[model samples]
Target: MNPLAKLDQLDLEPAAKTEVAALIQSLIEQAERDAKIIQAKDAVINAKDVKIAALTHELAYYKRIRFSTKSEALAPLQRDVFEETWNTDISAIEAEVEQLQDDQPCATVARPKRLRAGRQPLPPHLPRIEHRHEPEFCTCGQCGKDLVKIGEDISEQLDVEPAKFFVHRHIRPQYACRACETITAAPIPPAVIDGGMAAVGLLTWMLIGKFLDHLPLYRLEQIAARDGVSLSRSTLADWVGRLGVALQPLAERLAWHLRQRSSLHADETPVPQLDPGNGKTKKAYLWAYRSNDLQPGPKIIIFDYQAGRSGRHAQQFLQDWQGHLVVDDYGGYKALFAATRAHPETQYILESCIELACWAHARRKFFDLFQTSQSPVAQEALNRIAELYTNEAEGRDMTADARQRLRIEKSLPVLTNLHDWLQQTRLTAAPNSATAKAIDYSLKRWAALMRYAETGDLPIDNNPVENSIRPIALGKKNWLFAGSERAGQRAAVIQTLLGTAKLNGLDPAAWLKDTLEKLPAWPNNRIDELLPFAAPD
Candidate 1:
């Protein structure tokens, strides 16, 4: 400033003054260029710092996954510790960024906690056995006066009586006509398993025990021995086999009814099948198909057993059905959907069955990546998916039209944004990383995943069928494997009826007992009356 003032005071010639002004302008431009260089360097440094933080988080995530409890739930104290650490780290990063940008730190807001519910009371329907206790001394010690009767203290302790076995004597009185010499006796009521000592009650108990309770035949035989009733495993097996055959018609009816629906959920689980020839167990599939929740009918689940996990199994079972099929990203269903599209003229494709992909499957990919890598990209994808699920929850009980409208209004924009972000982010992601794979999987099934929003009748996932198949998964651990192909098929039949009965809120044992008693003389045309939902309350 002093040099410039001195120049002004110098009263120099015009050319000298112009030269000095040019020099000063050049210096100012150089300073501005230097400042720009520093800003660019800082930007690169900040980017690197973000990458380092993400990688550090990812490393810690992997370590926790490897060493921590498998349960996703955290104890209150553990959660507090985690939140404290996360907040401290986040605050530090925020402070650094604020310092770099010369900005104030934002205030932190804690999330509101949800209120816990009180203990629920026991059901009122159970029979009560009251016990009365009389005090020896009715007089109060301090007052020396008789205590007045006010109220009785009530407490309940549940008790159980061990299973009681009984026998039913079917008395058949025969009378001979004296003159005609003709003999006549009252006919015995028909049993589910004809000519077998096992009554309908015993058959129902065995079926319920094996299929619903997952008790193996040998275990049930042992249980029977404890009750002083010696039932051989072979006898139990015979009963089960006959019951399976008797219920075959009912299971077929259920399957037929399920296929008539406009939409269905399908899934499969592996069952080990004993191969006598190889002296080893072979893997077989138990396919479960469930009726749509929104469909106007009683919910039904049918399990089909197949020797292999082939698309043909599903195709054959679902033959002549044309509607939406919700399933996971199993390749076996691709052929079925393709056939539906190819043969629009065929009866199977008259309505052109649409393949609705499960959002759960898509979310699983990113979830797995997040669990393994804790990548910000994966987390962002998970957050977006969670929003879609939130929207689904809001529309869960809405009418079909209202639900579709809600999805179109709220979900469509999210999907569009997610699609764009995935496209842009994929370019920068490493080709071989878990995050990249998740992105690719979602983008590949983008059309199918997004299709759920188009119709309210379609569910977001195939969880109904998946849940239906869960019993088999649990049973497999105890039973190990099916004895043969026929045994596997029998299991499928029993499971189908039991599963459907449970879905309809009917007690499996009671339903089976009633159905077994009635199905023998029940009219063929009125078979639907025997369905679990149609049973008397």
Candidate 2:
């Protein structure tokens, strides 16, 4: 009854019948192969559609986050941290979408073009070194006779010098004794790097360029090469090492001062370290600790580089210091809050570390949920939290005692109501739902969250330290990763000094240059005088 089977019944000679059946079978096989090919093509098309849909969704999400007014949910400094990443991701997604569209057989919709601002005048404050371009011939092209010049068209372009390398020749004349024929020259002045060719100014430039500006040593070398200066990466690396050694005491002193404060902010970010054995990179941590901005003292930021995010690393850095520590909900810092725990170094029992939970972090949980689902519960929670922040914002410039009074008058009731609301909300929410998890986070840390309301001397959140760490996070993307543990630690040292300088409203380059010049001849006992901040008011 099959179509192919009918070939066998056809009336013909024996050889003709055999040839007809064989041809029909071959045709059936070819048809089956064609059907299989069509199915595979459909599957491929479906997969591509799914991929494009996902990419489109991601692109839209990033665009909304980047362009929407709600992007200001985080503090300016916090938002600044991820601005570059969002821009890069958006560009990458757009490029991938374009590529995929080109591959498709069907017509594709192009992305909407972003409106761009017209070119603006360059800053008038910049010292312009002008280069005038004049025509080779004063006469018009069509005319043989010379022509007088009229008003010239003028335009300005912003230009920069990467590094203007210069020489500082320190000439020391030799003096000879007439009788003994003894010759002597002035002794070389002390330098951060002894007997080094680099001046303090040059050292400062390299240091700031590599650490603060996030330029790698090789990049610095390349920059110098463009100026016809021969600076090998090896030499740059050696200078960084020596500079770290010279600046270590200052960073350590900063840590000492930071611990002396009654309260502080702490956080950590991951850094990559090269592993030669596996020929890949491994994770490291840069733990950042900062003095509370509200307290009456000089601002300080200390960076501690560790191979892992063990609680022990924090314990080691904190030592016997005890104070209110404003931090995120990282489990690593939980050990620090235990009533009794062995010291990281001495193994001696110590008092518990008072915890002050970060409101910004708690707010982020609800913020993320609201963004994703537009849940009324998240909105209500955000409103309550925003009320608390509003009170804090009003009292930001107030004295410690005045701020505390303001919080007691304003923030305490809101916090109490918010806690009650969260408890009630949790009862109705599914135990495994994201809403429940978010509620639990706040409820579990309620006491720590309320601590800041009781004392204005303590910070409301850990944004200060996180803000300080943001530069380091941004820097890693540029330099990629540390070549070794020593390199990471050295970076931490320089970052501490430079970051503190910036926090205290000092120009980092100028401060670093001055510090380098004084460090060599500076006495150990008087090192505090060389801190980024002048003596605390």
Worst 10 residues of 2 by lDDT: 106-115
Question: Which whole-number lDDT from 0 to 100 does residue 271 have in model 2?
Answer: 98
Candidate 2, 1-537: lDDT as tens digits: 676577667778889888877888899899999999989877777777777778889999998988884644666655776787898999898888777767866523444464568989888878988788888987889977887877888888777865678898999999999999999999888988888999998999999888898888888888888888999988888888998998999999999999999888889999999999999999999999999899888999999999999989999999877889988999999988985877899999876699999998898889888988999999999999999989988998899999999999999999999999999999999978989988988998999999999887888888888878888877888998888999899899999999999999998998998888888999899988999995555
The global Cα lDDT (0 to 1) of model 2 is 0.87
Error of 1 at 294 (Å): 2.5
Off by over 4 Å in 1: 1-118, 138-145, 175-184, 340-351, 534-537
Instruction: Evaluate all candidate structures by whole-model CA lDDT and list the values in order.
Output: 0.81, 0.87
Residue-by-residue lDDT tens digits, candidate 1, 250-293: 99998888888988998988899999899999999998899988
Question: Candidate 1 overall Cα lDDT vs. reference?
Answer: 0.81
**Would you list the clashing residue pairs of candidate 1?**
none
Candidate 1: 10-residue stretch with minimal lDDT: 104-113
Instruction: Name the regions of candidate 2 deviating beyond 4 angstroms.
Output: 1-67, 72-160, 341-350, 534-537
